[model samples]
Target: MLYYAPDNASLCVRLALLALEIPFETALVDRSCNAQNGPAYTALNPNGLIPTLITPDGPIYETGAILLWAADQKPSHVFPAVGNPARAAGLAWLFWLSNTLHPTLRMTFYPTKYIDAGSAPLLLTATRANLLGHFAHLEAHADWLDDTQVSISHCYLAPMLRWSALYGTDQSWFDLGKFPRLLAFAKRFEVTHVADQARLAEGLGGTIFSAPTPPCPPEGSAT
Candidate 1:
């Protein structure tokens, strides 16, 4: 079972599972009532994160961990295996997506969690700049970013682009066109069967990555 909320990090894991065509179930972690903080959900993921994938072995928390575990289940083009020459590069970018890029986005999305609300604007300014740098770096150096193959990095990155556009206090700063390569990638990936499945599941409307709109989920709120 995948504990998820619409438009949350869990969406990334969902995309990976769909791409691999794996059979699984999902339980909505109703954010509207702070359900993630409840005892039952916390028992599975102490962090109370949106996504916690329950497996035969045990429960796996963390979006990146769940994605990697799912990819490793069988041979697939989405993820490179341990011995593949591309695995090192792929793993490096995957961790970079998890550790570096994702946290930076969190800082922007929930500024009050990191600092005082009155000073959030200043923090957003600096953080938005940092985000621009991150995107530019990926555009120039991330050879692993491929629109055709749709690697695990694609699952991770396309959502970051979506959230960056839709989440922050000031979404105007993020312009997909500035990074043409990533823009192209989003345009391509959004139309794929994998992305489309996630779109319908989460009520994420058309152009979810390249031109995202606020989510309108069927069962629970995106917040």
Candidate 2:
């Protein structure tokens, strides 16, 4: 399998591949040059999104789908088991993160794409409020994020916390004290060699902190 992912959201699935301990090739989709918007990438994912996994069978798009597929490739110990109650719960959060939390994040980070320049602040403000609530909800389950037996959701979430710290207006929203368990887990994940491999493969520097801002706004570009 070939993992074609960019930075930011790419870490979600990239980390999964690492955690699954699979042998796969990583391809960099240079979103900074609008490479993801080009025809070559679009042919892989008609949606023109980053993070499309080209499997031997076919291309898999969507963040949750790719991560779930990664989880499937490994033993049940890495991901939730089929038909287990945990499977349902994991799917719920995965869907929520992709469908709800991620969209709100995009709006907060790059409001200009979602609203007119003059009105961007309003959307940003509202989106910030929404994101805070989402964080609070996650904080409610901070312990679960670092379970000894990690779930795919845990892999999916680490990147969210990292990005929240980097680009958010109020970094305290992800400050260690308030969101220790989840934030700490994410920070640890970022430093690991596996994380570095994924980041560097995408042309992001060795540490995620050293990664440059994407050339253009990625907000409202995908769900």
lDDT of candidates 1 onward, in order: 0.90, 0.68
Candidate 1 clashes between residue pairs 3 or more apart in a chain or in different chains: none
**What TM-score, computed on C-alpha atoms, does each candidate reach?**
0.97, 0.81
Measured with C-alpha atoms, the lDDT of residue 115 in candidate 2 is 82
Worst lDDT 10-window in candidate 2: 214-223
Winning candidate number (lDDT)? 1
- Where model 2 places Cα greater than 4 Å from the true spot, the runs are 1-6, 168-176, 187-193, 196-223
- Highest-scoring model, TM-score: 1
Scored against the true structure, residue 69 in model 2 reaches a CA lDDT of 84
TM-score of 2: 0.81
